[model samples]
Target: MNRLKNCGVAVALLLLSGLTLQAQDSTALNQSEKTIKKYKPFDANLQLRSLYIWRGFKVSDAPISDVDLHYKSKDGSFQAGFWGGASLNGNYKEFDYYVSYTKKGFTVSVWDINNFSDFPNANLFNYNNGSTSHFIDAGIAYKFDFKLPLTLSWNTIVAGRDTYVKANGKRANAYSNYVQVDQVLWQDEENSSLHVFVGGGFAFGREKNFYGDHPNIVNSGLTYNKDLVLFKYHLPVAATAMFSPEHKTGTLQLVANIF
Candidate 1:
């Protein structure tokens, strides 16, 4: 009878331990569910810059203000955005829209770029081939998973105003191309980083076109980026010193994000 009583006690203790383990597991699962992060689909921001420079050319010496609006997929593999910039002196204006898809470390995108500096009277909605100011570009980029971050990209103008005059006195698509490489020299846990980049432009056609003649090293630069906290607000800022070997020119720019 004592042996049977001890066996009963052992069985009750095992049952109690199993119940306790199951309850603990249930609580852990609930805590994990609560800790999962939620995705934000929409974002918008404005940037102010001391100068407007692109590729190797200085577009505007005046202060520039840029606005960006973007929508991203929940998984972050797809994005679409509109980016526009204007000079304070109102001499230069650009509106661009792009859609991109990313997988692993590769990204491909299409951009429609419109500049009103050349054709101030052009209609924004007009897609008429010869009369429109829109330039269509396609690009691909790959980021390497290395000890130091590295990225390479290629962009080409495929259609619209990026054209040249042929020998026969006819306009032809120039198909301007630009290739770039960027490396992150240093980055900290706080997201402050320094980057160095170089870019070159090529003309696919025989005639002169945008980005000038073929095979020109256009943009080479170093950028320092950091975030500052002031008055209980976080602000992001960058300072860039860029040089164009082809153009034999250099410029400095400062940018701030006002959110």
Candidate 2:
């Protein structure tokens, strides 16, 4: 009888030990999972502007609101986003989607640009050649690591509705291209900065192009940006003076961050 009692106590202790060991293993596994886990990062922005000006052209004369949502990699080397803008008077609307990758000081990106105002009845998903209203643009930029802070970029329309009529009355892809340079004149830690930029447009062929009949400077501008704290919230504001020498037009624009 005493032997049987000893055997029962030994079995109970063995089961208890086994359960404790299992619990400890589970806790270690949980900690290991937490250590290796990663979370995705995303950002959203909204802005209100006095006008919708892009490159060197006036997209909208009325007030416009812009919004963007983006997902950025943890290392900040990759990003994908959607950006949209709409005018208050309902005359202008634009939607664009892009994906970009950056390494060191060089960046490459592709953008799908859609101007709904130009083709109000156009189907959004129609990607057929010569029938779609979308424009696919590929761009590359390099930021010089200099004290003066300068960046240069070039972009070209590779596909979609970027077309023009040739001398033979045949529609041909224009392959419109724009090259730009930006330099920062001054900046402070408080996010106040002044910048000057210039851009020109040309086409692969010498015929009538999307920008103009001849290659000319299309965008030149000065922009001043400052961040203000209002009600304990960071509000960024900017003023831009833009001129289009090709069109002989100019505009002054104000922008404010809504959130």
Most TM-score-accurate candidate: 1
Which candidate has the top score in lDDT? 2
> What are the per-residue Cα lDDT tens digits for candidate 2 across 207-239?
455676678899999999999898989899999
Q: What is the C-alpha lDDT of each candidate?
A: 0.90, 0.90
What value does the lDDT take at residue 223 in candidate 1? 92
Model 2 segments beyond 4 Å from truth? 1-40
lDDT of 1 by residue, 137-230 (tens): 9999999987678999999999988876677988778788989999999999876999999999888645355776557888999999999889
Clashing pairs in 2: none
**Model 1 per-residue lDDT at 7:** 100
